[model samples]
Target: MLAKRIQPMVSQARRLYVELMFQVMGRALQAVSEVDDAVKKETQALPAGFLFEMMVMPNGPRLIVEHTGLGRLHYHGASAPRPVDLSIQFKHIAHAFLVLSFQEKTAVAFANDRMLVDGDISYAVRMTRVLNRLESFILPKLIAERAVKEYPSNLHLPHKLISAVRIYLKVATNFVETVRA
Candidate 1:
């Protein structure tokens, strides 16, 4: 049980998203003023309409990072009113939660599908490109750090990798399609 809860920390998708969001945000903010300024400025256009609910599935907490035309980055539970522009789901957000401290590697995480955007690819991609530029150079140290930080929990061989097979067998106990495929 404990392992399951903590397992997402090593998820490829979650880790990737965490790295990517930071990277993209940092990239878009370049030349705007400083990193924070760019995060604030570029996100200002995020539409005063909807909330992005990024849910890390199967009991992992939801990380809701929403922006609006109103001029600020708001986390979940903010009293601010809204019907937001896009509330894309990012399953297993905890993977992306840690170690987005840098500008460039953050972008890489997103590109890797650790952060899957669902609403509007155009806006998401545009944001991604902007963030990519701010990353002066993708350093090996950063990559190494991410790998070290994410590696221990990747229980890829059995549970995760073979989940499909096990679940199929369980569900298909009486079906022929289970073996046919």
Candidate 2:
């Protein structure tokens, strides 16, 4: 009886998720292509359109940026919303690439596993060079400020002390790890 009650809703949610993904992928491709074109102009050695792939794991994402020609660079993953492109894990990765800071060393360490690399190094190097060129100037920022916005004026009192304790424990664990390192 419970299964019958939930099945239709689950199907509807799945359909909605797919529709939204297509929308996001479409927009991301446009942004990537535009950035690539502009970067190529400033850097002479930049790839035209690359077909690089990435093997991103929980620890980090490995980039394999490739060039299809003199005009574009491709990262490995699902075909982006463009002509020459990199493939993203599609389900999990595209969002991470958009959000995570590249400053962390652990992320770079995960990328060093050669077995994860299934494609061209020249392409990855070329795309990396293009990204370096783009890095010179600040790219347009996409912030999720509103998503995490807190209404300080409308704050709610905690319903349970246990929940607060849990938060503290998590923070303590993180602190200890940092101190030990």
Top-TM-score candidate index: 1
User: How much is 33 displaced in model 1, in angstroms?
Assistant: 12
The local lDDT score (0 to 100) that residue 85 gets in candidate 2 is: 41
All candidates' TM-scores?
0.39, 0.32
Tens-place lDDT digits, model 1, residues 1-181: 9989877765766556654454333222322212234345555666654455444444343434455344444444312254434443444555446434443254455655656676776667544433332232222334534433232233333533343244234333423432475
Clash tally for model 1: 24
Which tens-of-lDDT digit does each residue in 57-145 have in candidate 2? 44333334444454543323333344434333323343333333332222242353322333454544543444333322222212222
Error of 2 at 105 (Å): 5.5
User: What lDDT is obtained when candidate 2 is compared to the true structure?
Assistant: 0.38
